[model samples]
Target: MSTVPPLLDGPQADVQVLQALRTTWSDPPGWLGSLRAIDHKTIARRFIVATFVFFLLGGILALAMRLQLARPGLRLVSPEFYNQLFTMHGTTMMFLFAVPVMQAVAMYLVPLMIGARSVAFPRMNAFAFWVFVMGGAFLYAGFALGSGPNTGWFSYVPLASSDYAPGKGVDIWAQMITFTELSALLVAIVLITTIFKMRAPGMTLGRMPLFVWATLVTQFMVLFAMPSVMLGSTALILDRLVGTHFYNPARGGDVLLWQHLFWFFGHPEVYLIFIPPLGFISTIISTFARRPVFGYRAMVLSLVATAFLAFGLWVHHMFATNLPEVGKAFFTAASLAIAVPSAVQIFCWIATLWTGRLVFRTPLYFVLAFFVILVAGGMTGLMLASVSLDLQVHDTYFVVAHLHYVLLGGAVFPLFGAIYYWFPKFTGRMLDETLGRWHFWLFFIGFNVAFFPMHLLGLHGMPRRVWSYSAGLGWDGMNMLATVGALAIAASVMVFLVNLAMALLSGRRAPGDPWGAGTLEWSAACPPPPHNFDTLPVIHGREPRWMQQALPSHVAGLAADAREVLVTSALAARPESRPLFPKPSVWPFLGALATTMLFIGSVYTPWAVVWGALPVTVALIGWFWPGRRETEQALALEQSP
Candidate 1:
């Protein structure tokens, strides 16, 4: 029999390490306990669930939009309601759903794939989830009170000014922006730190999994880019409440400032959403095909180049506003330059598939769809990047079509693939392939049917964001077709939900490594143990687990030992031997509740903001405060057995 030493029984064992291990394995608190479970898997699941809820809400808003615009003179909703629907729809999907879902997948899977016990900052992960939940609730409650934000998702200035809006609507929008961005920023920091510092031993930078690299790049982009939008929104809020003139055009505020600030964050935001999905596709493709990613070096370099180039292309969104010709040319060139790296990635993916033995699975189908749709979006983007072309098609249905293709195709499609791929890992049961295939084809066809005709409608000169249109423009057929497509898409989504429900209830139980994936996540028990691994894994190559499995057991045992190292920094790789990571607490939940009160209070009474702020601040401070007992215990445990 194999004799493994008990970790808790070691003479030199640290008490805090034991405490932390116990905490990590403890049953999550009821209702609130669920929130405190900071395991990467739990956090990731929370991210997916919360974001999916927001996605449903966002989709409902989209349906409302389609109903209102079903025909040229349909009065399904008022102009004001239409504005709120689109605005909230865009905001919810982009900020609340797309980014968070991507991040959630990362949070859950990255640590397992990279062979780490938990993320670098577990508490921060908990905090981000709570804050995001609170933010979404705030926005939803605002709508319930008939004060839904009507500013476009971008909330362009003057239109968003207090005088034009003159209500609590803009405040709700700004606060939602603040709340969600803050959560995203925290996630970015956590992921970046974890990626840089927490990989298993021998996992060099170049040898790091492609998903890790993609996440690293995306997090850096979020870290730097999110601030510009946050600052701009804050400025807008100040203008509304304190009479600041930053974006108030009549008071010497530049209307274009909002554009600059928004796109600064906005352009990179596209890549932030897309890159992680791309990473997911890369990992899934290589694993199922049993091949290393083609042009791995080139793929990594392309990601780096794309990250740098993304920031420079934001002004392409503002090309129609009559900027100086020189500035416009600069942005246009920058925008075109951004496409080169994307093309490189596409080429690399194609090469990988061409050389490898391709496995045709439901996930692979989604990846294939992603490639097709993303390419269409990229072509439209190239068209829009040109100053002349953009001037003609700006704010038209072309832009709408382009945005949907990129966001939905690039982010949502690949994410669906990832969910199907990882569902077994999360639920301990395989998702029904037959049902999943149905979901994929229906969504794929419906999605194309819905958005494809928008390009033609745009070319025929249908401006976007208009609640009603005149029927004689020859636009009614396409609009009606698009609505039908939307319903079809909805139906497909329903199928997916039903499939998920059936899978959870009584589908075939999954086996460990069902897909023969290369990463360490597949090495563990399906639905992995509460503490992940009893012993940390040793990573040798990008496909560590696969390589380990190929070797003899004795060799694999040695490899595991060699791979095991405390998570630490990339610069030094010194082990952070401290044990007993912070245990779960009710503080995050309490903090979120208090903050929600503050947001709702501000909407009704200005002084309510003050009252709301106090409890939230107190709750946060309490949450972060290190109780003397735990601190001393931690210190003692770190010092001695």
Candidate 2:
């Protein structure tokens, strides 16, 4: 009875139906199937989670440093431990936490906002995550083994060499940088491809979200700028490991070359971290304020201009290093040029607040805080851009203050704001508003308290990286105040963690569009579907989902189900052929495992490096393998169906 009942199945019928089902369910050939399987949301979630973990690790390192510096001349840990702490702290926070998190948020949100299913190169996206994980592990293992990089995150040459440091610490730094930058570069490539190639039917580049545009600019910056530093690190690694003379001053190696390469990537890295956050602030302000972004064109142009200008100003970091007067003046002028774009962004943000309805949600609070703190940092940056002023403040607490203000305000503040804004979308639950407010207030106040006095300390002749200083230097009161602020910031972070945990565990369910967000992501399920949308909606303008809601429900639903195709250009409204969705595979995870071994093996023995290379090569080959001829024939039929 079972044999006859199920689709009238004899062996032939059974075979036919099985083949038909396989044809129905199977994905197309090439890497596309693997890519489609991951989807944008999964990739984005991976990016966010991995980055958050790195943030926790980096934050712990920060707390350790703070404890050590809490008092004058009191040793909380050994000097070596302190060195590793600061280096790992800076490296982890900058490379692992800040930049990747920004990209992750963008990755998750951008395609959804634009009404696309997945990013271009979804497999590559998975690969980037694996590389980042491997890189972080390597850094952590190196630290545990007492071989953590000690040449500072920048890893100046002579200090990093075997002659001076005499260990594998610098090697760890170089390798970590290599792995992380490779990850960044991969992400950049994937993002650029997605943004340029995969917008919904009616979404023009001009009509794209400001955050999308900022991300696009950021990807280009990452592609061009990151490689320079990667190259520099490679050079230094060679010099350390194989007796190359690239940075060996005694052997005609120029330390300045290291400075050039580092800052070349470093200065733009500042914007790379800041711009996405700025984009977030822009989007949040406009949404909460209930107004269009002020000077949208200007904001977009400024972002582009900033990327270009960022490269020319790297020499500003070298002002105190006895560079030629001509070189100094060139950098000084280039440094000042950066102020133009920054000022443009600031003015636009202020204008947005002034004109918009300006609701004071938790996210908006952080944006407001960012405005105050960022202005303070920008002013210092302007001052530092001046050759004489930079010379006076270089290597001082002022520099430290300036960087923290910029990073904390520019990156961290907005990062919190983004978390608040998007928490509902990620978890399908609303974060506790009261706790969020508490977190914002505590963080904002504590942040200023911790960093504001550093400017005074810098002016009073206090230098950065000092283990301790005498109480008689008039730095005691400020140091004590700073410590208090640091503790407060730590408490605020604790509150955030608690809030996140509670929200995930038992928070109230959220609406699809909790904030009345204009983006397409808000139109879907709270956490979104695995495919993101059942059908991608055609985006006609900047606020597609918001506009969709204004239409009759049936009309909007019809619009949502249109057969979405990727487009190359807005002007022509050309449609590329629809492609099949990706299917899940173990290759990405296996590849990550191989890469991890390579990094970890390098730390243990030189022979381990050789052995490590084999797995990576094999995994990559398997990852890209075309499969059997029979599988290919079956896939070709499946693709047509």
Candidate 3:
């Protein structure tokens, strides 16, 4: 099992095997097939598209808030409506859009990069997507019905408690967290399994792509960081719905406990959003600079160190709260210390760019933007790490500016670059270079104009989360300027949409390896086939394309008559066995429906948890029920290949 099996030959036999694979691996025909499809690419494409739609929706919410704040005392929206607007904007961007989009891209790219046909737990992967859809839909449905959560995205209690904020809105927010976080945990499991046990032969832990390494690191962060929020949200919901005293101060519960749990996940949440983008930056930099990333081992170590240090910095967010001076000092030290690893990564990327020939494609334009914006953001982050600076700027537009600079610059810009870099691989065409440059410049300039003034406004004593302000408070000009810049951002997004549409329609067709890339993903056909590869590739060196200048360079002995993916050891990546992956089913969709009922119903009465379990149990049973064909196939492949 440690080596590849013999290749199939003979024209007639090869034809039959190939045909059987087409039959076995292809989705069932028509719309039904589309619904039941469990292919990683199918799920990832749908997941990615769904997240982008959420991103646009979140942006709309942001623009509305901007319009309301465009001038002092605008009164365009009531304070109540403004609350929901800002609340949903933050919640949607953080929960519905950013984190999931990164995973969605990883879901698509990881399998191809590792030369696996599909992610591990394909059924669970499908389940995760449906669950995510339900969660997002539920949140928006609440908003549409005028029951949107008015509590901030952080939803701090006392303000969020049942006594003060009594409604179904907070309940919806809490339950939505359950759905999204559950989906995230499932995805983390699927990705971790795929990376460790399903990598192509000879791709040991060392030889794995930097993106894959980043993904592996990010998922581990998810495993540790996600549960705290899940627990905290569940407690918040219980306090609201079930008469629990988790956050009720009068009931002997500590309000700060909520903060403890939330920020524990919250600060790491920043890294959760950014680490994958680091991967995107590394990939784009190496590909465009025409060399392997400088200090590859250092880059990998830096990523790991970043995740490790992210947990320690969460306490810094609570510096202004009633905490010990010693604790604040420790977090400040930890916060400043994290810059070491981050700076290491920056210097390594600089070394790679400086010594190598550069290709300034649209993707690189976005990547280069990351340095300017994120570095500036990082400087401000360091400033805020000081308790005095945080106390001065806390709860003000300065904090808002710092967050946007970090998240937008760190994640969003890199993500756009990734789309340009990989769009040809996703679709069979390239994005228009002219429109791309326009999109980048307008977006970059607009982002700064809209946000940078917020820092000065904060310094001038303007608080965030305000519905309206006095007319002559020295804020009108900056407010108008920010509004104009936001409009520019909206326009840039429109240009991007046009570019996407035109590129999909009649842009130049792409080759298998458009960038002359060195990774395994480039070895597949453009917009690769459903099975990914005609032959499951074996790895030789880190850059498989360069090491073995051939498409899909691996021996073939897998079962063509059934769905099979190679499994390997975690460290050396020695071949272990070929396991049969599950096929498409409607059960996951049904299961999500049943689970949604349980979650939403629990919002009304605690009894929902008691009775709702029945249908959920039934759906789980249906989901796991084995087919006769599957049993036979399993028995056939239980031996050596």
Candidate 4:
């Protein structure tokens, strides 16, 4: 039988081991080591920053479009340019910013929250972030070259093909879909493995943190949903470049085929953007309200139920496409059925606030805003669920208003709360409360003023994506009102930026548990050490920090010399084994760079796809190559810590 050495035997041994771990796990000195770093924190920060940059770019596009539409006949931009602007704006926001940002937040927080030292596959995590960054850059490059896709965010066929849409623009958009889908798929698998295998001992499936549970469910959704778009976009690129007629009606292809594939992926994409925010709301409410989340099991079931029902309602998006009436009725019912889970979540939040002491901080304020806005969005969703109503307002600004409400209210508002709630944990500094309040009110009022008018304009027969309209159409006043609101929204974002910048530079230091929170993440040092815990924590109950129970004994057999973490059973999170970690390497980044060449080059010729695989294969081989000898040497030569 094998016996492992004690990682912590006595007080002195604990100090020696912790000091050694700090030296071993911390980022190596100098720029070269920084470049080679594979730490999850480093990569998560990169993902967040990169996704924010895309958000800024996409927001600029929105403002430009809003400006042109501020008046009845403004010619600030031509129709073609405006088309490109909206398409790029929608595509960037949904694909490049919203979904990726949520995943980035998960990447940064999941390990810390779950009491894991690092993500399951740190190198793979880094690789996914880099791929997503490169893909966003490539798509924007097409915009810079005056070749951004004009077909739409969904890129409906024939209009997206070379015959109607010549040039490398649509091809660029299609290939970027493949890049992002691959990135999403990779991150989902790694995160799922991490959550299942790396939770602290005694953090059973039921005991898993709510955000971790939300992330687990979302990743599962990603695993099942991403392939449809990946396959669709691949076929689109192939048809455009090589004359394979996957979407061509002349070649016996159905026009509706693109709709089927895209919506199948697209509908779930909304929930993928949404489900985590539900977790964020639950966490923030529970934290500030001084209570455990009400209806924890019901919330988990609602998340899972929402994910399942999300797939069934994709057909509702095609209500105006002339599908059978029976099919339309089924989709309509499914779409409306989704409202039940959402209402359950919101009412649970209200119920929590009803019974507990409430702290109305910036985060909680945003959560409150989410409740009001999500309900408004959901009501419109119910309206649109009817086949007849969708036909009337299918392509109008009403649809636009509904989506923004759902997304901004449902996801972005909660995300703001999440950022506020976790800012201290990540940055080791508290954001200014006064400034946070200003940011919240400005954003909240501005968001309503901007979108609420769009509903009126949509009802008044204002179609979406049009550069300008006739002054006689009643849309002029509402459009002008929206423009004013848009400016307010932009100003609010500026306020947030200023507040964030000030806090990072000069904010007050935060305690490990600034809000007296209950989760494991708050148990670590503010901006936690490289080796998260000096000795791994033993979790006893759900609210580890709040229970006031005697702390459980730390695990003793882990090696202090090498990077070692315990792997646990999936359900009970019982200790199963220890796994050695891979050293920092540049291969993941190199592989992503090589893979990017394939995506970008394919826009020129299909031959690039075959050629691109060679470098990628080489990079993968090197990435997975073992360092068994060096690892053993490091472990054997180590003194007793």
Candidate 1 wrong stretches, greater than 4 Å: 1-24, 549-565, 571-576, 598-613
Please list the C-alpha lDDT of all candidates, in the order they appear.
0.82, 0.79, 0.91, 0.87
- 2 or 3, which is superior by TM-score? 3
Report the number of the highest-lDDT candidate: 3
Cα lDDT of model 2 by residue, 1-641, tens digit? 01112344467764554344334333344665544345567677778888888888887887777777767787888888888888888898888888888888988888777666677767778888878887888788878988888667887877887788878888888888888888898888878877777777677878888998899999899998899999998888778676789987688889889999999999999989999998898889988988778998999999999989988988888888977999888888888788899889889988988887867799999888888898899889989988888888889989989999999899999989999999899989999999999999899888888888889989999888777677677888888788788888989999999999999999999998888777767888888765466545666667775574443321111111112234455343345645443345567768877887786566546576789989989988877776575355445534542
Return the TM-score for candidate 4, rounded to 2 decimals.
0.97
> What TM-scores do the predictions have?
0.92, 0.90, 0.97, 0.97
Model 4, C-alpha of 505: deviation from truth (Å): 1.0
Residues 1-641 of candidate 4 have per-residue lDDT tens digits of 11123434677766777787777677666787766777888888888889888888888899999999999889999999999999999999999988889988999888888888889888898889889989998999889988889998989987888889998889999989988989999999989999999998989988888898899999999999999999999889888888788988888887799999999999999999999998888888889999998898898899999999999989988988868999999999999999998888878888999998998899999999998999999999999999999999989999999999999999989998999999998889898899889889888998998999999888888888788898888888888889888888888888888988998999999987888788888878889888787677788888887776666646656666667788999999999977677778888889999999988888897888899999999999999887777666555634334
lDDT score at residue 638, model 2, on the 0-100 scale: 41
C-alpha RMSD by candidate, in order: 4.0, 5.8, 2.2, 2.2
**Which residue pairs show collisions in model 4?**
none
Candidate 4 Cα misplacement greater than 4 A, ranges: 1-12, 551-553, 631-641
With candidate 3 superimposed using the best TM-score fit, by how many Å does residue 119's alpha carbon deviate from the native? 0.5
C-alpha RMSD (angstroms) for model 3: 2.2
